[model samples]
Target: MGRKTPKSKEKLDKRKEEKALLAEHTALVNKANSQTNPLSSFPAFTKFSKNGLDVTLDCKRVADMDESLIHSIFNLEKENMKNLYDECSWGWNDKKKMEEMTEEAARYLMAKNEAGELVAFSHFRFDLDYGDPVLYCYELQLKQEVRRKGLGKFMMQVLELIAFTSNLHKVILTVLKHNPAAVEFYKALKYEVDETSPQNSVFEEECHYEILSKLNKKIFKT
Candidate 1:
């Protein structure tokens, strides 16, 4: 036998109905948004494949990349990642972790060769600090063979297009002090460094980062 008061019984019934209605409403809203807007779904995946180069805006697909090519870029194994971790010291994440991180990142660009071998990759996350949305590039790398071939600029243009199409206000990236070439590249593209270091800036580990931003004229045009 169970003891139940009238007020408690009514409240419980009401709560159950509310929960069911809320779940149904959420499903309907999601379905309608997906149908109405393409971006609301899985965002967008754009690919640029030509002569010897192929560029794509995706991350999950990288896991399916050929093992041989992955090894050529950088060993996708834990042992090698450990060596990289020690050298980087900032703590590099594992493959599973990197995949997860990349998924959360809103935008990514991967450059591959004619053989479908990934040569360069870049990952960016959307930041909303500047009223409108802006993308912040967190990681960018290219294999040796692909360097000095104007591929870097092509990747940057792809990233810029992604940001513009997404209606973002600007694109931002932080370049570490070690990479002089990247710094020069961004400078050539008119990206400026915002050097507002904190009071405790003497630490060697706290290397200076160049914060660069490029506005989206399409979205901001008057």
Candidate 2:
């Protein structure tokens, strides 16, 4: 798609249109990131009380978070994800994982139970991904006790709400193929294989993960 000769007006117009759309996508993502709190819009969504589970949810950047809680979530993530990560092309590296989780750009959506214990978390960021404004979910890990009480579903719903409310084009995540339960969970939530996901013909047996996304119906993705 290299431009050779500057000739036709149609080509010029197409280039202008593409540039304008890219600017809109970048601006939308920038605005979402500039917000004080992504969760601030929906106050009622901060609480989860259903199926005998009661907890409070809050979003904070990794820098503003307490050190202990950061470590706690890191431990929880390792507990829940290490083996799954190990079984795939991405073997778990403690230092690398920690660095990613604590990066300045990272934000956490944390859930705490009645006793004020950290139970589940979703690490996400609002940004321009693959030329689209998206809320990229890095991790969604829950403690064993909170696994099936609809808490995981609730947390995912919160992520979707945040993304759509901020006008992000979609919510995206990567899930390992070995984790059947997790794969099914996203499918149940109506997420489909994203265009960016790997093709079987390309990687064949080496491919270990799938990228999934749910689009904002309000936004038409180009």
Candidate 3:
């Protein structure tokens, strides 16, 4: 019997070229979409002050932020804030993927002292596709040196006012279950969890996060 003939090399090469072209086209489309996407631009200055501590909140507008500023705020050498949050909260440190997190972050708020050192930061976002009028707190980080000075509370108030004035209905955040102090702090701010958030249950690998929410609709009479 005659042996079956093999396919020509030219045909195989042509198929490979076609696949490569399609892949390249897809990548271009995704890049275009990402570039055209409208990211929320925050004001350069958002000031928060109460009692005595003075703080200035702002967004990191420059693509390349100062390393010392980040380190002073987070006590980490990394340039990306998301990686620091992951390491501190979840113990999953992947610096390379930090840019992806920024794309998801709708708004970033940073607090700095009078000496020009970053003290705290907050990452909040509106859902990209859900169209729900809610703001989600992606992460909230305060430098260890300033944690007990009521700065966190002031930051929360700033976020709350921003959410209310922006016509949002609610603001939601999550805290590790084991972090009792954080949980208590939210409670002091009148945040309550519903059926969606439970107590004494593991919500994440390294930590159990309790989803806390605060509604913006006025509930009291003047």
Instruction: Output the number of the lDDT-best candidate.
Output: 2
Query: What tens digits encode model 2's per-residue C-alpha lDDT throughout 1-222?
Result: 875675766788899999999999999988988986788889999999999899999999888998899999999999999999888779999999999999888999999999999999999998888899999999999999888889889999999999998899999999898999899899989999999998888546767898999999887754
Candidate 3: minimum summed lDDT over ten consecutive residues — where?
Answer: 32-41
Q: Highest TM-score: which candidate?
A: 2
Off by over 4 Å in 3: 1-45, 49-52, 60-90, 96-100, 128-131, 198-207, 218-222
1 or 3, which is superior by lDDT? Answer: 3
**Best first by TM-score, ranked:** 2, 3, 1
The Cα local distance difference test for each model comes to: 0.56, 0.92, 0.60
TM-score of each: 0.56, 0.93, 0.60
| Pairs of residues at least 3 apart in sequence or in different chains that clash in candidate 3 | 177-208
Model 1: how far residue 179 lies from native, Å: 1.4
2 or 3, greater by lDDT = 2
In candidate 1, how many Å is residue 134 off?
Answer: 1.2
Runs of candidate 2 exceeding 4 Å displacement: 1-8, 202-204
C-alpha root-mean-square deviation, each candidate: 10.2, 3.0, 12.3
lDDT of 3 by residue, 17-93 (tens): 87786665444333323431112333423666665678887754223355465445344223434443464645655
